[model samples]
Target: MKTIHLGVFEVAGPQVGGTLSWPHPRSRSAQFHDLDHWVHIAQVLDRAGFDFLFFADGYGYPSVAGDLPETAARGGINFPSLDPAVLIPALARETERLGFVVTSSTGLDHPVQTARRFASLDHFTRGRVGWNIVTGASQNTVAELFGHTTMQAHDARYDQADEYLDLALRLWQTSWDDDAVRADAAAGVYADRSGLHRVEFAGEHFRSSGYFTVDPSPQRVPVLFQAGTSGRGREYAARNAECVFVQGTTVAHTAANVADIRAQAAQQGRDPASVRIMVGLTVTVRPTHDEAARLRAEFEEMQTDETVATLYAGNTGIDLLALDPERSLEQLLDRDDRGPVGQMGQSNIDRFLPKDGSAAPTVRQILDDLKGKGTRGFQVWGDPVEVADELEHLMDAVDLDGFLIEPIFDPADLEDVAELLVPELRRRGRMPQEPVAASTLRERLIGADGYFRRPEPAAASAHREP
Candidate 1:
């Protein structure tokens, strides 16, 4: 019965999940590098009352067991991406109250660089920025790109990620005090030297002994987001993230995940209710039910089984191409001693692999129900009213905070939602009547009662180990 929160999942590539919408006549995904395409989408969402736009980035492309496919380029799958961070200032210039969440990995990027970039983004976006902290994905492929002689163990990466976040926190939360700036032209004093403290963190994977380069921006730290369903990932998100994302296969499963994360947050010395939970959602809306169904049919035609295979193999590092169709997902996970999946990892494996006494889903299931019935999360296809109805029901069903809209087409699917779905949601009192303006992205997006208040973390010096 609370007002529903919302965000759109984005990437700087033509592909998202297994959907081939970029090839569609109406899709603008092919022009991904163009600011015009992004600006248009950002403006549309800003007008509609969307809270934030999240870019899911990664350093690696799909390569199963170190096998590079020549077809990757031809397929135009999840490849050939521009770094999404570069577009934030432009989008911020175009819209107000639309926060930006950029994904950066601890394994692939140094903590200092991550801290500096996000601080700059916070300043550029006027406090409308978030960081989706991920360990890394596509281990073998990314390792090759970074010239890692051997891949770090999955849990070990999480261990290192723990320290990485602390280091970044020192820069964001402790390096510069809120009143560090003293802009008094008469005295020629711009900053107080006493307020700037040097960060002296020496973790296993990183070390920093200098003062944080940037001054504190609004919110001090960008809103923290985490999107991993693995056990270690759940603990990591619970302990650190203000916003958590889940890709649910069923209504019951996602609800359980929500409860689990909240419970873990409580155990981790944080408020259970303050960990905002968002599920991935794929919406297909039209003026009529028949039109919606027809549109959905077309989407299914575009989202081929091979595409799902690519998505699965890339995220889980399990090569569906080389495996027997009948093999269980657990069997594949068992074979990989290094734990192929970590943060931003293995949604399908967690969904399809049977933990109950039931038979495990075969690798072939990724085509059937895994990637079937549309893209990830709770899916709906109908008129505006019908779509809105299902969304409300699901929100209550799971005690959800928001949904990450995964557009099947770049701007077209989002256009349909903005044009058709938002008005109905507003009419039903599930959305604000006016655009949310002059609010910090933290307060407007993830920081509130229904959406969970963004907690102010203590200064990083307090976290130093004795």
Candidate 2:
């Protein structure tokens, strides 16, 4: 049987699942700025044998609903977000085993800088770093932060990302030879000059001509993670990502995504099994089924309709406030007056739409469905054994590698999973009872065999001595 991997999903902000999550009495999100809060969570996950701590990030607040930022501000929806890159090293220092995956947009940062930053992080974490590649999905992100009057066309953004990744890969994989650094005290020499090569790359979106400043860390390159589920996105990920993050509203939807990604990977000359598929999963576990149900109900009650609308608007770039609540999604799609569907929005429709594409869910119904549910991932609630059973069933049904656990409340929600659910999973032999340490994040996630190995430099040809 294939071993299952587990990771915790988090964001450096006031709320994770929904707008009202931060205000809950048990929520520790208010301490987001405090290093101790992050350290405690990191330590908890590390001790629980989690494979990694995945941090989702964004550049701008959601403003798609009525083109007003006040809704997001009032609801505290993804506002006050901090850069995850700055926090990763601190978290890495606090935990010995947990890996860190930070989001960086291919559309925003230059490839060279991105390559250098992650390379440094790889060294700092001793190879416990991964990059979650995103093509800036929100128009607000491009307009407010990138100074673009309009968001790049969806396919165009992916086209740019394709080149961006190609340039980054060359910098990480080809710039330094394995034997580049040779410290010799007698000769007072630090590096073998011939072993270092300058990467000269020219692409439609990027150009770089330099050697990588940082030497190769334990992993050479951080594990690549891609969450895009569009046709272009899937192709890009299949060619590059070692781990793919996917979200779906149902089991069939998610399983289909997994199969598509694996098949695409095979087409790219990569072993389909070499790429791991992690589906998003939200859980509310208590000692008894009744207690769990009550907790879920309480969380749901905290959600407001406006908050849900604002959150969805921010994601899909469709102004929910402007649309009639009674209008069906099918009707909205038919109307040309509706604005362009953002990349994230398009992905959401693909995941949540009825299998036959005939159901017409109204705006009110959509918001009602999303209310109290913190994320798009599948939700599970019950006692430890029941939760484990659900997870195992999903795994068997979907062929998922593992799950990215979405936390409703910072440490408290995670605490329940660690204390209650984890033991149940261990008992079933679905997860390891003890934590296993690996030298690099790639080794931990996919093992050494799956890691990309750099080819050794060829020896100089023999010649007659002059």
Candidate 3:
């Protein structure tokens, strides 16, 4: 049996995206800004032999036509979004082996700024850092928040990202050399001047013409992760991402996604095996089936209809409740009565639009679908053995690399996973008996020991040239 990788899908707010259960008995909503709370969760996951904690973030909330919904605010939807990148170092300090993958946008941060920030994080965590490369989520809302008059089209942003990532890769892989640092005390030499290279690159969207200020750190470039599944997104992931995150609604959906990405990666001149794919899963495991079912019932009860609708509106920037129940999603977007539209998440909105002459899903039908799963679709409910069996089957069936264990209840549910689910996996030879503490995150994730080595000087670089 192959050991599966695990990561907790987390956000530093009242709730994760698109779920409305802040009032659940096990919710950590009261401690969204509490560092000790995060520290405790990090320690728990580290002890469980999980690989990383993945944070999904954006600077937008539920608003329509410049109007904020009272339900989203009162129900504590994806509002009060905190910066997860600022919270990683504290969590890293409290754990030994666990890595962290934080979401950051190419549209929001300049390449030089992003490069330096991840470099600092890499040094702080001793190589346990990864970047979830996002072009934009809730782009219109984010663009408005950042004072942009208009948002770029979906594919256009990905084009910008290609340029942004190219610059960052050059800075991380080219600016320093193997023997750049030499702390020779007697000679009073700190760094070998000849070993440090100053880089200059000009691209369509980004440019940098200077030496990277930070010295070489372990895994100089953070593990690259991407979470888009559109045509453009798949291409971006194939060409750039080492890990791809997908929230597949079914086994077949996930399997096709995995196959497409691997094939695209091959076409991009990459090793198909290098692009690892992960799916979102929310598990409710217990000692028995009846008991797990009972707990799952309570979780379902917490998702009231209005709150659920409010979460959908906030995330997609369409106030479905205020619109006609019979109107299709595409029709609603084109309605003159619709409010100020932000371009935060095009892929999310695109999923609902009609293709060809096919009829689009109506507002009422979309609401019903939200009631069905929304963000919690790929979940499993059962005791330890059953959950582990499903996991094994999914990995084999879909060719998945791992699962993002979205907590049914943030830190509280994770405890159950650590205690019940992981031990069973270990017993079945589906997990390592002992985890090595000293391996860098890249080594732990892919078992590639020397994969973090630097590239050749920029003069003969494989990356895009200036």
**What lDDT does the true structure give each of the candidates?**
0.79, 0.79, 0.80
**Residues 209-319 of candidate 1: C-alpha lDDT, one tens digit per residue:** 887889888777888999887788888999899989888677887888888899999987788877788888989899999999987888777666666677667777766
RMSD of 2: 3.9
lDDT order, best first, reads 3, 2, 1
Per-residue lDDT tens digits for candidate 3, residues 340-406, read 3434444456656735466778878877766736655477889999999999999899888889998
Clashing pairs in 1: none
Q: What is the lDDT of residue 365 in candidate 2?
A: 78
- Backbone clashes for every candidate come to 0, 0, 10
Candidate 2 residues 63-141, lDDT tens each? 6633557767877887768987899888898899999999998878799899999999999999999999988745555
TM-score of each: 0.93, 0.94, 0.92
Q: State residue 214's C-alpha deviation in candidate 2, in Å.
A: 1.2
Error of 2 at 128 (Å): 0.4
Residue 135 Cα positional deviation in candidate 2, in Å, after optimal superposition: 0.4
Better of 1 and 2 by TM-score: 2
- Candidate 2 lDDT trough over 10 residues, lowest sum: 457-466
